[model samples]
Target chain A: MVLEVRDINTSYGDVQILRDLSLKVEAGEVLCMLGRNGAGKTTALKAIMGLVRPRSGSISLDGVELTAMPAHKVPKQGIAYVPQGRRLFSELSVAENIEIGLMARGKGRDTRDRVLNLFPVLNERMKQRSGTLSGGEQQMLAMARALCLEPKVLLLDEPTEGLMPSMIAAIRDSVTELRAQGVAIILVEQRVDAVLPVADRVAFIENGRTRDTVDVETLHGDLSLVHKYVGVGH
Target chain B: MDFGPYLFLAVLEGTVTAAVLALTALGLSLVFGVMRIVNVAHGEFFMLGAVLAWWFSSMVSGSPAIGFLVAIVMAPLVVGAIAVLCERTVLKRINYDPEATIVATIGILYIIQQLALTFYGADARPVQAPVNFRVVFPWFGYSGYKLVVIAASAVLLLATWFVLTRTRFGLIMRATQFDSETAQAFAIPVDRVYAVVFAIGAMLAATAAVLIVPIQQAHYLMGGDPLLLSFIVVIIGGLGSIFGTVVAAIIIGISDGVISVFFTPTLAKILATLLVALVLVLRPQGLFGKTPR
Candidate 1:
């Protein structure tokens, strides 16, 4: 296993969020975590990335223990998180925002060219403050910033939330391309159809615990299982 | 009454005051910019700088020029090191909590003040200016050192602006200031950044103090006026704004210079306080400060 999390329990100040959550992913695999709102999907990723402390568990990346590590150090250990809400430094210019990631990891200035290649629009608006960009543009900047870390594991929280349909398709294509490059990804997404093609397996989470893990092909043939877990109207 | 010459003198004096105040208040603004903490002890750092300058200048033999240069270089470094130590030992312990850090800094202020009084004695001491030349104006002669002070402060302020806008260090500081949480996620050690910022802020205040010590007597209690003026400047300039701090310092510094020359110094202070109240009530975000999102 490239990344393994076992028996992880986490809480936010007495409000328990995840209980005995266990998951695994191999290199080049895209693990899509599907759940309704408040189903602990974000919390699971947060715990794995060391943004929030897990009470009891083991999080290992390529056999190295990552539990209890500081969030700042997590990226250096090969994990990059594109947090919810994009969280781009609004006042900073686009180039500066991407530089934050590279500076943190001590990567050379040339690495920016590679990340900017992934999102060409960002390259054009390198001098513009990120807050002025449209939602789609800002999202692209966020992804580019994370990719600057050159992480082995990418944790994306709601990358498609509130995006237009066209933007969602663009993000899906980026995710598929990244997965093919052998970067392990744990994507927290609500849009099932947008994620299905890219996801090798989907973990259905309900009320802070994983209900089951199903292969994408098997679940695609029987849409009712997804409906049962995620609700009707798909 | 021939008031024209007096008016020119007042403006010159105000410009001098404004120059010094800009350096001091810029330090305060930068601290607030990165740490979001109101350093009540910032004035004490200024006091320490002046006090150290006096000590360093007095110790050296021969011309005052060598002593002044030595003090100028030594004071800010010593003060900056002291401040970094304080950040590590005290401020860091409080987790940089807004209210808690304020209280912590206030405590530091008293500790430093009392220590100065204990060791430096109660008498105010003046350091001799390295250059004792005068530039004769139309009505009167002005100390060339005062003019040098004004020019030096301007150059230093410009250098500060360059560092903040054009350098990689400034880039990291701005990124940390914009959103520390996001910066941290990218692997910036925010705690260390905070420590460095705290030191730089203190060092700026120290630089201002070292520059001004030749003109004014260094007293343990002299910090009160600079402290009050700096707060006024930071508040009026909008917290954490470098450009705004400089602009506001000039306005207040010149006004105070002119007002004190014509009227009582008490009234000048009153006007400054009134301006603070007005800015807070009308444009709380300050002239250049962005509205909180």
Candidate 2:
């Protein structure tokens, strides 16, 4: 496994978010985490990224313990996260946003050129401020920024939350491309149909606990499987 | 003197004030812009710089120029180190909460001021100008050193601008300022950034103090006016806008100088305060600050 979270418990103050949640992903695999809102889907990803401290749990990447590492150091260890709301630096130019990500890993123009190739639209708007971009374009920039890290594992939190169908397709294609490149992905998404094509396995979470871990083939054979856990159907 | 010479003198004096105010207020703005915390002890940093300049210069027995040079180099470094210590020890402990930081910095202000009073005493002390010469203008004569002050301040301001816009460290700072959490996710050490920015802010204030010490005496109580004026400059310039701060400083400084020469110093202050009130009522975000999205 490239990344593993074993029976981790995470909380914010007195309110617990994740309880005994465990999951694993191998290289070249897309693990889709599905659950109702507040089912600790986001928290699980955060725990792995060290954004939220896990009260008691062991998180490791390639057998390297990451439970005690600081949040900033997580990216340096080859994990990149594309958070919800596409938090781009509003005042900065698109190029500058990409530059910041490159600065983190001590990479330069070569990496920036490569990342921009994945999102060609960003190349044109290099001098434009990110906040002024269209919603879809902003999402592209956020992903592009994360891609600058050249991460081994990518954690995406709701990449298609507010995007249109075309933008959604673009994002799905990018995820598929990343998975094909042998990058491990832990995706927290709500749309089952949108996730089905890209995901290899489904880890259904309910109330902060892993309810079931099933292959996409099993999930595809029975539509009721998603409905039973996520409480929603396409 | 006639109105022409009188106005010329006022403008010269105003330019000097604006130059110094820009450096001091820019420091405060940087701290606020990145950290999102108001440092009430900023003026104390300026006072500390002047006090340290006096101490350093006094230690040297040679030419006043040698002493001034030593103070210029050492004062800001010492002040920056102290600011780093404060950020790590006090501000970091509080997690830089906006309200709490204000109170903490206010406490810091008193502590720094009291310490200055205890060590340096209550009497105001002056440092000699490094180069004693007068510029003989057609209408009147002016201190050549004051002109040097203007040139030096401009150079410093330009250097600061270059650092903010041209360097890799600048990119990290801007990113951290934009969204610290996102910056962290990309492996930017935000805590270290905060400490460095805080130190840079204090160092700027100290540098400004050292420059002005030859003209204005270093006194325990001298921090009050610079503090008030810089606050006005920062507010009117738009809280975190560096360019706006410089522009606003020039406007306020010139007006204060002109009004003081023509009318009274008290009136100049009243006018400046009223202008701030006007700015607050008309445009709360500041002249150059962008409206919240």
In the range B167-209, model 1's lDDT, one tens digit per residue, is: 8888878888988877778887788989999998899889899
What residue pairs clash in candidate 2, if any at all?
A: none
Q: lDDT per residue, candidate 1, A159-202, as tens digits?
A: 98889988888888899899888999999987788678899989
Q: Which stretches of candidate 2 lie over 4 Å from their true place?
A: none
Residue-level lDDT of model 2, residues B1-293, one tens digit each, is 88899999999998999999999999999999999999999999999999999999999998999999999999999999999999999999999999999999999999999999999999999999899999998889999999999999999999999999889888888888889888888898999999999999999999999999999999998888888998898889997788999999999999988998899989999999998999999998889977766
lDDT against the true structure, per candidate, is 0.90, 0.92
Least accurate stretch of 10 residues (summed lDDT) in model 1 chain A?
A101-110
lDDT at position B267, candidate 1: 92
Q: How accurate is candidate 2 locally (lDDT)?
A: 0.92
Docking class of 2: high
Deviation in angstroms for B172 in model 2?
A: 0.8
State each model's C-alpha RMSD to the native: 1.7, 1.4
